[model samples]
Target: MKQSNRKVSGTLRVWSGVVAATLLAGCGGAEPVHPDEPFPQTQEQAQENVAAAPIVESMDAIALDRTLTSRTRSLIRARLAQGQAQVHQQVPVVSDSGQQLFLNDQGLNGDVTAGDGLFSAIGDVDFVTHQATQDRIREFQARNPQRPLMASTFDNRVRVSTRPLTALSPSVFQPGVPIPIFPAGITFAVKPANSLIITDASVINDPTRTYDPCSNSGNPNGVWTFNHLMREMANTYVSPSVLTEHWLRQWTVNQNINGWTVPARTAMMPYILTPWPRVGGALDLTRSPFKLVAIVNRLDLGGGRGPAGYASGNAGELRFVFAAVDRTSGTCGVRPFLVIFEYGVPHSSCDAVKTWAQRWLELSAPSMVLGSSAYNAALASLTQQVVVRNAAPRKPNGSAINQIRTNEEWLRYPWELREFHLMGSGPSVNRLQGQPTVLTPGDAHNDTPVLRDFINANTPAILANTYTVPTTFPTASTPFLGAFPWIASDTTSFWRATGISVNEARHKFSLNTCSGCHGRETKTGFTHIDEFGTLSPFLATGMSDPSIAYVVQDPVNTSLNREFFEIEMRASKLDSLANQSCLASAFHRRLTSAH
Candidate 1:
């Protein structure tokens, strides 16, 4: 059987009920006054004038939670889990820039430094510091005896290995390539053979290269080490949550190499192999997990003063902010991407909101290792859920489907028809002061002349719904006047998903032209164009065609249209049915491993 296009059949009724309730509230218990009488200024005054206004206070939560939704919550949970698994427990091997020495406790204790270089000692030295230095020298000698320890002009500097040291060749690390070495010492038996050993008193001419055993193609300076450098990468940001720590631990364990002094050495290897390698690698190594990015405590102003709701008193009433960061490598070059979620709290207390934002940001930020694509993939996956779930479904009326079919026919068998007919009716047509006519579906003529006339006459209606007051139904007039339970439910879901503010999503969808179809014509009327178009007495005055040309003229609207076009194009680019189906599939996959 052909799949039914109807996912929701009762939407019209549901929206109608909502509209009725809104109208009742707006009328404010007053009898219909003459057209000449001034409308009530305050909602309370309106209520006094109308009979039985629906109590709207009960629904105020709708605007409060517009951004939070269940699907979004799930996605966020998945991301948090992945982040925790990928980021916690991994030891940082390199410095913040991935160019200097910084290792785990055990590795640091066993290693020694001399003139900006690290080495292993062959024998005991006078002090703890000196012994540590000597141990590195001995370790280097054990790997290369041909070059005995040579004294440097600088005190405490010794060249223990005969092999010369080479500077890092690349600005970024590339996977699968051998690291170039000027002087060879204990050659690590890793697959790439880039690992090196050092001796006490020996000053590694290029300490940067000594620690980074991965290929140096992407990172020429060998600055992409798994140490603090990975933690500092601008693009390697994450949302903080319980899952964040879990992922970190998972990455640390996977990257831990047996007998390796730098624990990050093992961790970073996996990152180098992945795209957006640091976060991706960490996520991969940790087996993908989920974590929380932020949470909503309360919205200070219920009435327009928040990011999600309409503005009322002060525009700066919203107080909350959400933020995330990634730290991997400087050469990684991607900036620390941040998303700010604002709430209805006063702006004066933004600092407190920032504190919350920082908590999540720090949690999500990658630590001493290159975060892998797995983390980013998890984020993207979660974000996709938000985008998909929040996207307004095609109009329930078969009109959208009919349009598609009509467009298809135009593409296929071009000669089958000589003229095109755009169907539908409403006040949309009235916008055309004068234009040529086109053959509608019922009309018989297929000739070009007939089509030309139809096009000229009906072109105005074609642009009608596209630019109207937005498609989403308006739930309330003045901020906080009415409540939408669905909005609250959606907000809750979003909170559970990403822990960031859902306000942005709510605002985006609320402003969608499609949703306006369900909205009431007047603040005190129960009529919506979608249901009571003919019955609505105000239809003659309330409805106005949105200017399609305005959409093309306004930069913001143009950008929005461009983005939508790109998305449609991307969907069209799929080569096979299977690929296209995957894009629409709702099945959820575990982004992280069971471990």
Candidate 2:
């Protein structure tokens, strides 16, 4: 299944242009704060304040709404609108071998072959080319070393004519001519069913051919099998179900952690410290924050799971635990942090995973082991700083504080389709059937501008107007949510290029988007649904459409209709809202005139 080249069909086209213009305009605005204003307090002061504040329990709408102001909310909404438009318009062309190419009409055209000098026209004027079978055979022979030779006989047999004299002399054959017969051996006598029969040497060496459980007892140091290693790894790590819950709980608690303890920090240290040695200079911390969170472990269970686990459990299990330690108070609590993990059986004929795990353990042992006290102290200090700084009120003179807050709030709710799914329903709804959209995280294709803007506009109070030292922690002005949609868009594009349907692609994108904001609790509720408004009846229904069970049950709907419907619906909804707002008066006028 192939998705349509047109990303922004019909209605989305207009809105996309509007969003792009708005984003460009927003970027040109002056910095929100004045240069003359007094510099904000030191980083230590901010940390102390964060450490002193009380930790919140839940991240419900009430809490989010309370935290965000009108301006911030507007910003988030605008950003969401813009992100949708961006994702819909950006159609990234990716190959099966993981090659990514930006696609447009020109690129699409280039992929098609037109009639040329070497190529001949086929049926209906289609261009086609023919090659000799002998050439193909030669290429095949070159690639395959063990090709068999076909038996053949010489047709011109002049030698047979010379042998006619010998044929003329043919006469009655001798009666006792010895024939070259293949060797024939006598069958061994059958032994009684219960009787034991054996040769001395064979018995000692072979033992029981029928039932010998310990055949390879002599090879003690033999390679470990993949299944054995996978089992060991599984036993080492928490189960996927449990791990998922653990990560969700940790993020839900919004626990702070010691920066040193962060897996990403350690994973990325080599790249940061030795940037020039790597292929792309040093690892860009800004682009690869996941490196800080990722931890390579020799132990079988340490690597985290990916999103594929939701269906067949190919996704590994990741247990992300966020804890904030207050050094001054000597107290530790859960904090908000993103954790992703994957789990699955290793692909190996034998001892593959075992060998890999063994090698990894040997190499990563130093970084894999974590001491409780050391981790606690690191987390405590990091938490104290983040809490205090984030809790402080923004200075009136500048917008840095605002920007920081925006970024933090954006992170808090990160754009995901799952969030929208949850927002559409409540506790009254039976969540067995999950949301319709599958959302991903990260801006591989750079589609997060609108979401960022929206978050920036909505969370005015949390915006940071001043810069603080140690800018790593979440701040009021950080555009956490801004980057989410972009990430999700990229992930979706990657999946779609692999022949996913637009509807299912949208559903997955939506799931990632909603999950970014709603967390893992919403995963179970992320069930598949049918067009008849019923829960998906099929068990294996990721890309499969419940509405159409026939026609080979294609999960990916590669056609343009579904995309068109979704875009039209989204645009209409936005247009209706714009009609009611004075800010979009000009837009409404243009729309009305076009109609």
By TM-score, who's the top model here? 2
lDDT of 2 by residue, 224-327 (tens): 11111112222322332222222223223322222111111231122212221222442221221111111111111111111111111111111211111111
Candidate 1 achieves a global lDDT of 0.19
What range of 10 consecutive residues in model 2 has the weakest lDDT sum? 121-130
- Candidate that would win on lDDT: 2
Candidate 1 residue-wise lDDT, 1-595, digit = tens = 0121121112223334332221110100000001111211232332222211111100000111123221110000000111222332211111111121222112122221222121111111112221223344466556656754321110001111122322233321121121111111111111110000011111111243212222222222322112211121111122112212332232233221111111221332233223323353243322111111222122111111111121111111211111111224534221211111221222112123223222222223344111234433332232222122111122111111101000001112211111111122222221101101111111122123432343333333222111111111122321211111111121111111122133222222222211111121011122111110121222222112100111111122223321111111111111111111111111111000000
Q: Against the hidden reference, what TM-scores do the models get?
A: 0.15, 0.18
RMSD of 2: 31.0
| Candidate 2 residue runs with Cα over 4 Å from true position | 1-252, 256-342, 348-449, 452-525, 528-595
